[model samples]
Target: MLPLAGERKNAKGIIFEKAYSRNISRGTSTLKRGFAHMLKNGVVMDVTTVEQAQIAEDAGAVSVMVLDKLPSDVRKAGGVARTASIRIIQEIMDSVTIPVMAKCRIGHVYEARVLQETDVDMIDESEVLTPADEHHHIWKWDFTTPVVNGARSLAEALRRIEEGAAMIRTKGEPGTGNVAEAVTHIKKVNDELRAIKAIYDSGDNQDLIRMAREFKVSYDIVEQTARLGRLPVVNFAAGGIATPADAAYLMSLGCDGIFVGSGIFNANDAKERARAIVLATTFWNEPEKVKEAQKMIDERQSMLGLDVNTLELRMQERGGSA
Candidate 1:
């Protein structure tokens, strides 16, 4: 069973220690993968307050992402978007039973440590926040808590996984309420994976070796990914998903799940929209069901979306050379 919030200890008496102290082995990696596995085919909503967390829980969200501001607000109020206050995170934890994930800026290991200490189910090395270090992302292999990082291409995704990110999400132009960028990103990853699989089927190890070198990841990771024809870790679509159709569209495009940031609370019907997004994500294959979900809220009430081109600060561009 997955560990519960604040349950810090297992029967083995393992105390959550500094992430760097944990031994690097297959067992540890599997632990992170397993946690992400549980959240497959679900929607993770971004929330700011305990009330919002409760609403998300009631709306049937599989998990809630705790942050100080919604992505849209983050874009409006330009500054460092750090982790949410621990006190608020704890209160939200108390308000809901589902897994709670908190964001830490890229390369901010100390912030990640604080989140791990708070016993959040997971940490997001989010590009949506202002990056603390542009040259490097946190060495996630050092942490016990699993991390979900963003990527725009297969190479970026593979590199993050090699660095011990248990899950990956497309770093779509966040806070913009535009799904175009997210669609482009997921398509980019899928196309690259297909290309790699073709090379693998041709019995070309040299190409795989070259790709491994180019991605700065081990050959084993490249080989495994080619063999699987997809990311070894769970993959989710995130950024500016504003509607149920957007959620289902991503699911149809081979994403394991969707992450909604400004879509929910900023809308006029937070409760109805949240519930509809969950339903749409879970029943993505059925067009009728998705239509029903789409009708749950009025488009006029949707958050005023910003054009990706007009944005001065593009959060998705933060991570690396993707």
Candidate 2:
């Protein structure tokens, strides 16, 4: 069963009123696909296991990311799942048809191959909490199954898409335990894209390339990413997403969706947090709601180290293994 609306203590030591989203519809926008219709009114919920995944689906997440294992725990435990157990993977898939995504270590094609046999909808060459076989970019063309890889910058995002990734992400690192890094990265990419567009529209073609490069998009994807203001998925702003405002903020950035990792399950008020975050996406443009939701997050939210450079290096180090 999914996580029910459980009672919990709050500032006044009173049980907080709780509710969960039942889907997103008639929201600020509908989730879009490609450059246009990627699950616009979508949101992602990350779960450590199958039980929580079912809960997320029940609570209205458009999709659920089920980790093979959690990095937060693995940082304490010594090892990682070379591959998520087939039984556990199948359990989650069985529980929900709303796009169950399973993560595997980078370059661990065997794990992905196995997940494919189970009929998963997509593969997230994830580098978050329990990353394995990390790679600079997942080989999208190599897999028959569609992939969603992390992009710290637009260049990486576009390159992955160009390489055949069905979806591209902002690479909001997993288990950073803080939202600031994700926020900063998201802002940088968006700001850079905006600047590039401004310069391009100004007819400064010579400098536009250099400027777009700053945001991380390659020459080809600049045309594509710039064609649309938002990303291609159900763009799920992940990582330190912990509260309703956090989810709302991503929506404000034109994100199609928000992906909550441990944030939902770890919140002091899990059900309320989930409900609020779920509702926030729908009411994203509302100033009063954003004000009310902002208070839920702590001012000191921070993220740990996850230099994509280092991850790229790690991915490169395994070149011979592949």
Candidate 3:
């Protein structure tokens, strides 16, 4: 095993353990966190083909997530949605200089192994795809490649982080083209964080232990989160973001970045909307700039959005609430 720059190896240490353990050398884990940090305030577009991947790169996307089906199509078709074809993932990897990510069914270790071998920069243990293991998620520490997972609350986010997820995205009702669920999830996390922070400020270690037990995560992880006052890793907004305004709105809600899937290719103006969403996310704090991005596309030509309430399946709920 290759030793991380400052990581001293214990012969008995977990193989590849430097990848995620916060208790290990801070430098190693911080390096992984920094990779995601570089994409902060940027947009990560989902692409199915090399052409679309190139378009996303051209539009200033920080990264592109390669997937077999748009979440909406995954919902519409109603079958087991798996990882992208390796051929397509490789083609997209060849096509873009920016980071390339691909999704794996939740807990699908073999699929994730295949993606890691494909040399993709990141892996999303995505709920947008069908779940491969109902009771457990992949043990991400076993791999060298970084992983991102979805969460709806602080407890869920902390659990994924403990499981070695390098990043987190809200598991909003995907493919619906609605932002409400995303907003709700982010707020739920934020509210819980605030509560934990308050408990920390009160100097109540016992209360924190209670919280750790309640969240079913490590006490150290909860304590560290309270110390940082946010997720230790990057947190991005995803699922159902269909417009530039939707992207900016999530940024304002404190996500480090945004992930837009069906919102782009499924629309009438892929190029324009793609560019607009990138601009919106980057300048999310600037209201005037957001308005400019909002005006870049014709709303009539946007994807016919579905209401979250009307959807028969909520992709966000697939991973059993954690």
Candidate 4:
């Protein structure tokens, strides 16, 4: 095995090893997917500064996503959004012991390449940033670092996975601080998964093939997902997740993990909210524990949420068709 760096234990006592077999190679499908699996049932928070990254780490976040601006600030700023500064990404990586992730614009291969060269633990080909390519996303297989992409349906998720995305997240309307869209998305993916599972179970190969065509993914991958009854990769709930209840509710809906963007630092009680969301995500199955976590933050201190229907920019739709 080839040992890497940044080995650490999660709040659940899960030891994440930065090691992989040399024969399999560093960015092979198994190693990339395994990197995401290590973060299952944990929270990944977005932060623009080393201070916020440190807070996320101290709050038991599995990893911190470095961004040039918080999603809310991005929406308000309203210019072309790009990747965070390499210096800032490296600074945050140096500040924390946990793995660090940074975002690159969709379809911007060079941006992804730069992030990979920065040695970030992961790269998010995120819609939250202004997409550089309108009809094509970055071909993720070309990079040595694992990449994560967002999806609102099974088809999008499957297509990204087919393109070598190591992880998938729901493209909830980012910066809204509203969990409604995220809920709708995961439910839609679940509904589609159930439909495919039934088709696969009925011994209908023709129907499975047709479904694969409809999803725009390979038959083998569609069949694999149907047999498993879940995503082929770790699926996390993200965008506008503001409260402990929001985190717990999404977990109950069967997400492998949670991603908080702009929800923490935008709120009045960032430190408490960050820790509370992590606690709620970790103990989502237990109502009493979740309630304890919810009490840790005051609602009045939460980020001011925007109505999804009234938003001018629907970030979720950015790279859906691409």
Strongest candidate by lDDT? 4
Q: Relative to the unseen true structure, what is the C-alpha lDDT of residue 321 in candidate 4, on a scale of 0 to 100?
A: 86
TM-score of each: 0.91, 0.72, 0.92, 0.93
Candidate 3 Cα deviation (angstroms), residue 220: 0.7
Instruction: Sort the candidates on TM-score, descending order.
Output: 4, 3, 1, 2
Give the poorly placed runs of model 4, Cα more than 4 Å off.
1-24
Clashes of each: 1, 17, 0, 0
Once superposed on the true structure, which residue ranges of model 1 sit more than 4 Å away at CA? 1-27
Please report the TM-score between candidate 1 and the true structure. Answer: 0.91
Q: Please give the lDDT score for candidate 2.
A: 0.58
Q: How many backbone overlaps does candidate 1 show?
A: 1
TM-score-better candidate, 3 vs 4: 4
**Cα lDDT of model 2 by residue, 1-322, tens digit:** 1111111112121222334643322111111123223445666776767778877777777777777555444434554445566788788888887887777666566677777677766677766534554444555555545566666665555555555555655656555445565676678668756865666567666676775556454554564455454443434566767667777877787666777776776555655566667778878899688666655544443223344433422221222122
Which parts of model 3 are misplaced by more than 4 Å?
A: 1-27
Query: What are the C-alpha RMSDs, in order, of all predicted structures?
Result: 5.4, 13.1, 4.8, 6.2
Model 3 per-residue lDDT tens digits across residues 9-71? 232113433555454542244555567888889899999989999999999999999999898
lDDT of 3: 0.86
